[model samples]
Target: MTATDPRLLPFSAVLSSLENEGAYAVMAAAAAVESATGKPVIHLEIGQPAFPTPAPVADAAIAAIAAGKTKYSSPRGVAPLRAAIASLANRHRGLAVTPQHVVVGSGAKPGLFLATLALVRGPHDHLLIPDPGFPTYRAMVAVANGTAVPVPLRPDMRSFDMPALEAAVTHRTRLVVLNSPGNPTGGVVPLEHLRRIAQLAVEHDFWVVSDEIYSQLCYEDTYTSIASPPGMAVRTVVVDGFSKSYCMTGWRLGWAIMPPPLAERVELLLVHSVGCTATFTQEAGIAALAGGGEVEMLRREYRKRRDIVVKGLNAIPGVRCDRPQGAFCAFADVRSFGRSSKEIADVLLQDGLVAVLPGTDFGEQGEGFIRLSYVSEEEEQREGLRRIAATLGRLRPVKAVA
Candidate 1:
């Protein structure tokens, strides 16, 4: 506990470096607003699914607990859960992902972090992420001591800019993070773009870490995976989980499929970071994958909700929005409503009593936009839209006082 002994210091370098990340800032603000107002905030910021975990999944967890299956399991994951994930992969993506290649952790984020650690090598190694991308990717890269290089996707919300991605590659670029049915904007990466990115990764000898947690939640087209593309398996590491797909966030269970060579290191990293996932939780995840219809039903509802939000947002004057193809978010360009996305978010929070994630929270390009999660009840969706329209009007170019 000496001052010279850095481990005993009051400050932590890792913790200090992550202080500027904005995901938690939005959460904290929402928490304070909810507590202070005592009126429920129309929460559009979090990426959580509003649907309850399926009865079957919940039942399985209960049954496992009743049967006293709470003991610690292997760091890699329980045999049956990983096997079920592999089976699901084979059936869905035509990839023969074996359980041996799988490693499970608390959630998809942790698995992603572990993948970053295992795949990112040495100082100044770089990972590519989409502009206005998942904020966690940048945080994970920083935590791994790897540089994050932005690969700006098309602003039209159509596909990844292949040239930008290809041009960003270098020897130090060890990982390329891909998200389809992306978070901030629900744009699905077209198969063609994925193929080009995969080809570039192959040519550059870099790995692709595909976060496919929202694979089944697409609206217009079926989900595709880099691993399923020809000649991609050896260089692609798939990170997925039951949280979004099964509404099983509290389960703290997610799994990763890595190239066999990297599987051991990822598992070891999981061991040191989290030791092992709860055995009962993995058991529940097995039940989720073994039966997947509830997720399909949820997807139908989300498609409906997305329609509601897109139509509503577009109706609001000066708030242009695109209909997202996948994921349950509507990224609306609200620059006309306010000077900044954060300002629009603040106005909504105060005037409309709704809180959405400002686009700036995602990245620099997100300044004039805001991400709205349409995971509320149908009635809430309609009412919130009404409120947003009225609220934005009130906040519009304030030349006069009411």
Candidate 2:
């Protein structure tokens, strides 16, 4: 453990950086505040679903465990689960995939990590990601020694800017990540925009890594898969999981659909890295796919909570929040207050006993905003908004003029 010891040498730069990710830092700070204050902090910082795993999935897992299914599954996952995922993707997303094209990993997060590892050859390759995007994308690219170029989301906060993407992409760009109903902003990309991006990828000969974990949570519009575009299937890797859609976060199961060869490579990566996903978890995933009604109920409930949070946030004097078309988060514009997003978020946590993530945690573009996850119960969501409104109202005298 001494500094001179070989083991004390610097760890992988990317792994070291992931330890300090803004979201995890804020969540830890929130926990500390709650502990010190002896009062429940309103948690709008984490993106986990407030609900428990659905009964069918949990039951299936328990049964599998009791039936001695504790052994290892294939790196591509159990055959039944892979077939289920393939069928679901083909039917819902209009993608033609088979079990052979599916690669299951521990979670969608790891699926993304493995995809980047398999796709990026070295530091010379570029991975184009969205600014104010899910931080994991950039972290994964870095872990694989790929240069990450962040393309800023449009000002309206609804979708990616085509012009910006066009400017960023080049022959050296190896991958473009598409997160519809994106994290932090909750802005769902339009289908036409995706088609255009798909065309651009085809022209540039870059791969597309589509994270569709939130596809089942859309409210105003149906979710569209970028892989559905003509001639894009072979070039697109669709990553999704049972966590968000089925309230199975603790289960840690996810799948990806890619061309057969790339899928094979990713499966190999999984085998070397984690060996395989847990067998019982894959069984639970099968039940989740069969029990689709649970997600529908969740979507309905989240829509109601989303409405509450958006309305409450927009009503604040210096805050303007756009109603997110999908996902369980509201990105509120707090630039009118002039304070840095971290300052505002800190004030909310310490003074208002409300914990929300600052926009800066996402990227530079998130500097003056805050992301509020409506993933808590309806009552807690309302209370969180109330605290935030009061906090912002108190700052109006000093911050409004800025």
Candidate 3:
């Protein structure tokens, strides 16, 4: 009866389907624990690099701001930045792309969201995403009003179960999202798997959205893109950014490379939404692309951290961790302790004063596991591992539910 009554306002049903990234929630809880106890907390939750932004990138942004480059630019991004992105793609991914094929966004997330929006039409359309993958993949599908079909990863947690993926594809499938050197698991898709996925996309006429934000951090001999397979270039959308490798998470610059026509539409979505990424950040992106030495050094450091985490986790009584081929997170199996991922993560944060993410935060497949980021200092990682082992040891194992 009142103007402000709940009955008068209807919210989109999609609101209930959305979920927050678990890292932030765990981060806050860890902060609260530290505050209450007046103790320092070891951080292994958030995924950003511990290194500062490379000096060249910081200087470029400052110079751009001083030169009065703060005004609005094309929603597609500044010409130089776009060109640099295209060049990076061509050299790294073996794709022939021009500036017209690039559409920049505030971060890799926007590019991923826009790709979903462009492909998924309605509930009738389905998007296949990895289970225990980046949470945003499902969130984007929900926002686009498309059905999300989750394909389980293989038991190794390194790649998709091909049989499961093939069976999941239906005529309604419009998009399939791939994150090589994926989040949470740190699994890198093998080239053979990429070829198979490419074949499936071509047969089903579904577009592939490859999230390669961590491509530069790969510990393997070589990184391959789904776009590199024949017939995939036209159908694959490569979403990447300067956040991870460049240590420029706050810069908020990312881009998608697609066919020229789709790039145009994605750019239009950009125009109506966030308008354009910050102009000075684009300048910094150009410098990041040009400076590869620091990127390699960071990759080497991450490899060392990964070794420390995986080895230490294995030393724990009931924990098992595989060496991550890429990315900076170690997905450790803690099921032997007979606790849910959330329960283990909470104990780690509240008792051990160490921050880590519950595996369920990624998806149902992440249950019985915990994700620990190795982006902190090497000593901090060791200390966090010690705390985790001690905290987990205190809890007696309960019978696992069937």
Candidate 4:
């Protein structure tokens, strides 16, 4: 083998299909620019929580390690943690989820991958994922060697454009991936529309994978679960976790709950993929799930930060942001600005030392948008938004050509 050829290790064919993800690139740029400028990077890029993980959850993990629960348990995860996830959903969502229906793993991310692996019947069948939704949705579909059909949403109104979505579905459709308190756009589908999608699922005989990871991170409205919809429970696979709610990202704990039948298949796949999450982490999950006030403190703080970021973002010129009803993000339209979303992001990084993800990172339709996360301290958010205003305010708005 040639010297240069040896430098590259052989990997899955999927490696070639993996395009450079834009949001990650944006974060890299933010890091490089801030390092060069010696500026404290006001990170509004990633969706991680602003507050520390609840103390009890951290304590439980530490305690588990102390007790020598570090060994791998089961592919289906520790029974206590899996049961805790089911109980939490049933109590909070008012949907009866049983331990037999739950399968835990490293995090919502891996659980999601397992769901995709278990759901897609063949390479030819397509999965419907929302446009401008979580980039991971599309990426996961590719990793599973399946086609991803993007169902576009109207960012201006922050809801699904029903007719467009309806047209995208074909006889080859096998799964529909829906995310509430959605990423990038922060669009939450109304109950009525959710039912309509469920109805369509019944008509098409397709399985539904609803991502409720942001279930707890909402404002102005109560969180909804697709499984709560009558008759949909059997066809829907609900995925949610302790990361966003309990601020337990590093803990790497999450669960996938499906109707009992699919849960079995999911467990088989999970076994081959991760064997199991650490035993101690599962114990910590139990602590997070049982009723507590620590999680509420984080919710309260995120709500405040959302307001802090939203108000400041709205005051910026050539940029208009919709009030997000849920999630710690504001979807701002920068179409009025003379620059494209990428250009605007670059200028902000160079001028204000602020990191914001371009709308285009989520979907092509997001070209005029920028996702501004409020997952930072209040004072930092205020300063970042002010810098954004100062930088964007100087640019003249350009009129679109006829």
Candidate 3 matches the true fold with a TM-score of 0.97
**Which model scores highest in lDDT?**
3
Question: What's the number of clashes in each of the models?
Answer: 0, 0, 0, 0
Clashing pairs in model 1, backbone N/Cα/C closer than 3 A = none
Candidate 3 lDDT over residue span 69-161, tens digit each: 999998999999999999999998888899999999998998999978988889999899999999999999999999999999998788899
Candidate 1: residue 245 Cα off by (Å)? 1.2
C-alpha TM-score for every candidate: 0.93, 0.96, 0.97, 0.94
Query: Candidate 2 lDDT (Cα, whole model)?
Result: 0.88
Model 1 lDDT per residue over 1-402, tens place:
667897777665656656455655776787888899898877777767777888888899899999999888898888888888888888877898888988888999887898888777656788888888888888888888888888776876656677787788887888889888788888898888888887887788888888888888899887788888777999888888887878887788888888877899888787888899988888889888878789778889999889889998888778888899887888888776447888888888777888788898878878888888898788888888887888888766533211
lDDT of each: 0.82, 0.88, 0.90, 0.81
lDDT (10s digit) by residue, model 2, range 1-402: 677899777776667656356767888898898889898888888878889998888999899999999997787889999999999998999888899999988889878998889999998899989888888888888789999998999987767888998999888999999898899888999878988998999898999999988998999897788999888998999999988989887778888899999988888888898999999989999999998999899999999999989889878888888889888889898888778999999999999999888898887888999998898888999899889988878889345522
Superposed by TM-score, candidate 4 places the C-alpha of residue 1 at a distance from the truth, in angstroms, of 9.3
Q: Kindly indicate the candidate among 2 and 4 with the higher lDDT.
A: 2
Q: How well does candidate 4 match the true structure in TM-score terms?
A: 0.94
